[model samples]
Target: MAVTGGLIYRGIWKSSKRFGPFPKLAVAGILGFAVGKASYVGTCRNKFQQLGLEGGPGSGPWSRRGPSGRGHRSCHHVFEDCKKKDQVAPAGEA
Candidate 1:
């Protein structure tokens, strides 16, 4: 992103000559990184919410972790849990 921004500033933006290219390049790189990180976090949050695994503290994915913090279940496990919760027996059945 910094490289691209530098190229654009040097090659196109004639008005940017006063402040030079470094500032624009730096701004572009920082903005790009921040936007990318935010996008990734948002995507994960949406996916977890959709899977009903983001209810927070005692119910969110983090709740499944072990004392060593290495027992986290994969998405498959969460999906299976969802399926089980959604299954229903007939009215006459228990």
Candidate 2:
């Protein structure tokens, strides 16, 4: 991103000499690296599944340490129980 911004700045803002193909090559290299890593990880996942292994040790590819977007199931149960009690509460305790 920096290289791209520099190239654009030099070409338009400064109107100075271009940085040749270096900036383009740098961007391409960065993108290529990202694609390569994704492909490698995907290959590892496929092989692991083929071997019938559940998950490996030490931050395995199959392990998801991030949020699943569904929130926690235990928290949902607690909230449901609270709602149930609240519905049954006496009118004097409102």
Candidate 3:
């Protein structure tokens, strides 16, 4: 879904194809991706929260590394000991 949204955004904002620069398109791609992802994520999260669930984070997902020594995991990710797993990423690599 984000990829589709990104394509739409890229067409609208990058139609100019930048002017007289080698890196202009690269810059545009970077900016377009940031804008598109932020907008898409914000919209989806807002819509989900609007459903009126209790105490949901703004991302509709929690972060790992809770204040407690016990780790936390959002629906989007699994819990793992980051300190111990620094040598290798958690399985299913996002």
Which has the greatest lDDT? 1
Candidate 2, TM-score vs. the true structure?
A: 0.36
Q: Which scores better on lDDT, 1 or 3? A: 1
Q: Pick the candidate with the highest TM-score.
A: 1
List clash counts for every candidate, in order.
0, 0, 0
Candidate rank order under TM-score? 1, 2, 3
Per-residue error at 9 for model 1, in Å? 6.2
Instruction: Write model 1 residue lDDT over 44-83, tens digit each, in one string.
Output: 7777677655442355344665322334454434456544
Q: For model 3, give the 10-residue run with minimal summed lDDT.
A: 60-69
- Of 1 and 2, the candidate ahead on lDDT is 1
Every model: Cα RMSD to truth:
10.4, 14.3, 15.0
Q: Which ten residues in a row have the lowest lDDT in candidate 1?
A: 66-75
Q: Write the per-residue lDDT of candidate 2 for residues 37-64, one digit (tens) a residue.
A: 9889867877766775434243343235
Residue 46's lDDT within candidate 2 is: 72
Q: Each model's C-alpha lDDT? A: 0.58, 0.55, 0.52
Q: Name the regions of candidate 2 deviating beyond 4 angstroms.
A: 1-18, 50-53, 57-94
Q: Estimate each model's TM-score.
A: 0.37, 0.36, 0.31
